[model samples]
Target: MNWPPVPQVDLLEGLHLRYGVLATELRLLSDGLDEAARTFRVGVGNGPDLALRLAAGDPRPVTYFVLLHLRDRGVDAVVAPLPTMTGEAFVRVDGLTWSLYPFFDGADGWTHGMDVQAWHNLGSALRAVHDVPPADAVVPREAFDVTRYDGLTAWNAASR
Candidate 1:
């Protein structure tokens, strides 16, 4: 991503305190780095590594609200971040927002070739995203709801 560099300390602290993930190693997934954000492949000791994205934004709740809305509608197209311990989907540390997601190891679309079916699947996913209704009128009560572990549950229920 075409974004400025962020401190590793800020990233680690946010992940640890917000998501309770104690990462042992933080490696840059250089392939996906763009101007909007910096992507990191976080290694949490013996557990499966997670994906971390550090984007320059001032804590936007609407972003996560829309993401949860789409996922609850059966659109399995987007990668929604795991919410924080306080149920916030995005955490701010040092003027940058960080979010964590379960990492799925796969080929980089830029380098890896795609088959016809893969292309069709991509189109279907995009269509699913487009079909979701807007959430401009809702109060987003679930966006800030607190949960100890299953943070997104409240958001899912609120959307329904």
Candidate 2:
């Protein structure tokens, strides 16, 4: 799938510098990845900058939960501007990236208001996903767990 062009990493690096993760600094990382491989495979339209900022300097549990939960549910389908996660790193999607999804013919955006069946299906999906037992997962906490109001926080190399 061909994705639209993305902005430079420096544009997001400023934002990432405010947070902790480099999902914001997509340009440089994106420079190496094939746009075709990174689409939908990368950050779905949730805007990696926002997700990264929200996840930055938080507890290991939150980070683990958010990332794991998103992965468990296949966030690629939900987030519009999919951000690609190549191992631990995340880069923005580009035209070169591609993923073969089961073709669903339709326009984008919500087509219906809340329906009983839709709610039920959403609930069912969430329940099933949550039921997946957490295995022996290790989320080592970083040293600067606390994030201040202004944005800058200690990114201790201690936490991995």
Candidate 3:
């Protein structure tokens, strides 16, 4: 996969100054223009792993709010955004938006096989997230129309 340009040392230093994230090492986790972000696994000495994301065009404030809400709801599965030294959820460094999160180690179900218990755990997490009360006007909701897939609809009709 095509990865975004790696962050330079100066930018990392800026992150250190702003967020206190001292990156001893960095490993690219994923990149996508659709997501408008590039993620990295930041290694810190004697500290838990951190996920640092550099986003060009994302509604980060809203996203950060939602993550914080989930965390407040006691949903431990979600990776909540870490606050900067100035108590900001995210900061801009070198013209790119940066956010930090606690990294959780887990295999991708798409690449690595998941057992029945794993699936159950995933379902439980999803249920927990759904049980949380919405932020109402704070977060906007998007409607998904499955009927938009004409080919799939026709196939389902024929199969029935």
lDDT of each: 0.80, 0.37, 0.79
Question: How many clashes does the backbone of model 1 have?
Answer: 5
Clashes of 3: 0
Those runs of model 3 whose alpha carbons end farther than 4 Å from true positions after fitting are: 1-7, 31-35, 140-160
Quick one: ranking by TM-score, best first?
3, 1, 2
Instruction: Encode model 2's per-residue lDDT on 9-35: one tens digit a residue.
Output: 533553344323344223122222333
> Looking at model 2, which ten-residue stretch has the lowest summed lDDT?
94-103
lDDT of 1 at 111: 86
Q: Would you give me the overall lDDT of model 2?
A: 0.37
Cα deviation of 132, candidate 2, in Å: 0.2
List the pairs of residues colliding in candidate 1. 1-33, 1-34, 1-35, 2-34, 2-35
What does each candidate score in C-alpha RMSD?
Answer: 13.5, 15.7, 8.7
Model 1: lDDT equals 0.80
Cα lDDT of candidate 3 equals 0.79
Give residue 88's lDDT in candidate 1 (0 to 100). 77
Q: Give one digit per residue, the lDDT tens place, for model 3 in 28-52.
A: 7763344667777888889998988
Off by over 4 Å in 2: 1-9, 12-66, 69-86, 89-113, 138-160
Checking candidate 3 for backbone clashes, the offending pairs are none
lDDT score at residue 117, model 1, on the 0-100 scale:
88
